[model samples]
Target: MTADRARGALAVLQDADGKFLCEVPCGYIVEPTASAYHIRRERARAQRRRRAMLRRRVALTVALLTVAALLAALMPWSGSGAADKPKDTTAGTLEEVHQPTAVLLPSSGTVAGYVPNAAEVEALAKLIYGEAGIVPSTTEQAAVVWCVLNRVDDPRFPDTVLEVIEAPYQFSGYDPEYPVKEEFAILAADVLTRYRAERDGEENVGRVLPAEYCFFTGDGRRNHFTTEWKSTDCFGWTLESQYTD
Candidate 1:
C-alpha cells in the first residue's frame, strides 16, 4: 500500500473498487470490512433520526402544557373577583352582575309589594319607639319593627300594619297621638323599603326576626322576642298555639 502524503496523518486507505479497507490514525491501524462501514453509517443515520423525533416530542409536550395553563388561568374557580360574580337571573336574563344584599328604594312612592303611606310608617315607627326606643340598640328597634311586619305577613294576625299595631292590647306601646322619634321614623321607612324591594325580588333582604317569632314582651330593660307564649303577663302571644289549644 502506498501512503498518500498529501492527506493528513489520520487517513483512510481504500482498495481499487473504492471500498474502505482500513484507517491509520497516528500510526494506529484499524482494519474494518466494507459491510461493517456501511452498517456503521446506517447506524449513525438512525441515531440522527431518533434525536430529531425526540426533539419534536419534547416541543409538542411543552406546547400542550402552555395551552393547559392558559385555560386554567381563565377559569372562575381560581378567584372570587369578577369571574366569580353570580349571574343575574331576574326576568330570564343571564347577564352577570353585582348582587347586593339590600338595594336602596327607588324615588317613586309606590313599590312592588305595598305603597308607604304616612300613617302606616308613623304608626309602625311609634310602636317601635315605644317598645324598643328606651333601649340603645338599633337592632332591638329593628327587631320590634320586624315583629310587627311579621304579624302583618302572618295569616293569623291583621294584614295591614296599622291594624296589627292596633289589634286590641297586642302592642301596648302604640298610641295614635304619641310623639315618634325621627330615627325610628327613618328606620321604619328603610325597613318598609327593603320589604318592598324583597317582594319584587330586587334584593335579598333577610328578616331580622323569623316569621315564626310573633310574640315579644319587655321589662323596660330589654325586649324578649319569642316564637311561643311565655306567660299570661306577656304583651304578645302566638295566635297559632292559642287556636290549637
Candidate 2:
C-alpha cells in the first residue's frame, strides 16, 4: 500500500472525517459529533424539565388532596333527616336540672301538626315568659308551652297558637306588647322544634307533659299542671271535661 493507505490502516480509532470512533460494549462503533452532542444536551435538558414538571404536578395534587381532607374533617356531619332538625341550645339549662325524658304520643285532634314560624315562636315566647315566672325552671317553661300547644290540639279551642292565646280569658299572660325574654325565646324554640319533629313522627323528642294533661294554673312562684281542676284553684274558672282532649 502507499503512505496514505498505511496511515489510514494505522488510524483505526478515527473515522474518514477524523472524528474519534468509540467501541461500545455491544460491539458498535460510535462517532460523537458537536451537532449530535448539542442534540443530546437539548434532549437531556428537555427530560429534566419534564421530570421537574411531573414533580410539580405531583406536589400540587398532594396539596389539593390535603386541603380537601382538612375541609372534610372540619365539616359537621349529621344523619339523614337530622340536618334540617332544629338544634337545641339549652345545654346550660338542662345541666341545671335533670331533664325529663320526653313522652312521645301520636298527635291527635284538629291541630296535631305544626311548622314553627317566627310569629308563632315570638307569641309563645312572650306567653311563656309572662306565665313561667321571673326565674322559672326549664320544666315550667316547657310546661307552659305544652299547655298552649295542648289547647291548640283540642278541638274545643282554636286550632292555631295565636287564636288559642287570644281566646279571651284562656291565656292571662298573653300580651302582644310584651317584650319577649331571650331564655323564654330559646325555650319556646326548643319545645316547638320537638313538637314539629314529633308531629313528623320523629322519635326521642322531649316533652314535659302528655297530650291529656292540658290545664295549668301558676301562682307566681310555680305552676301546677293537672288533668282536672283542683278545689283550691288559683283561677276560679271551672272547665268541663269537654274542654280537655
Number of the predicted model whose lDDT against the real structure is largest: 1
lDDT of 1 by residue, 1-245 (tens): 32232357866767546665565674654443456667777999999999999999999999999987776555312101232222222221212112211222334433655656667777776676556656556666677777777778888778988888877535666656555555667667767776676667774463466666677766555677766545334324222110111
Listing every candidate in turn, what is its Cα RMSD in Å to the true structure after a full C-alpha superposition?
22.5, 19.6
Position 233, candidate 1: lDDT: 47
lDDT of 2 at 226: 62
Error of 2 at 229 (Å): 3.6
Q: Which stretches of model 2 miss by more than 4 angstroms?
A: 1-115, 231-245
The residue pairs that clash in candidate 2, if any, are: none
Compared with the true structure, all predictions reach lDDT values of 0.59, 0.57
lDDT of 2 by residue, 120-189 (tens): 7778776765566353357756777877787778776679888877665456566666655556666676
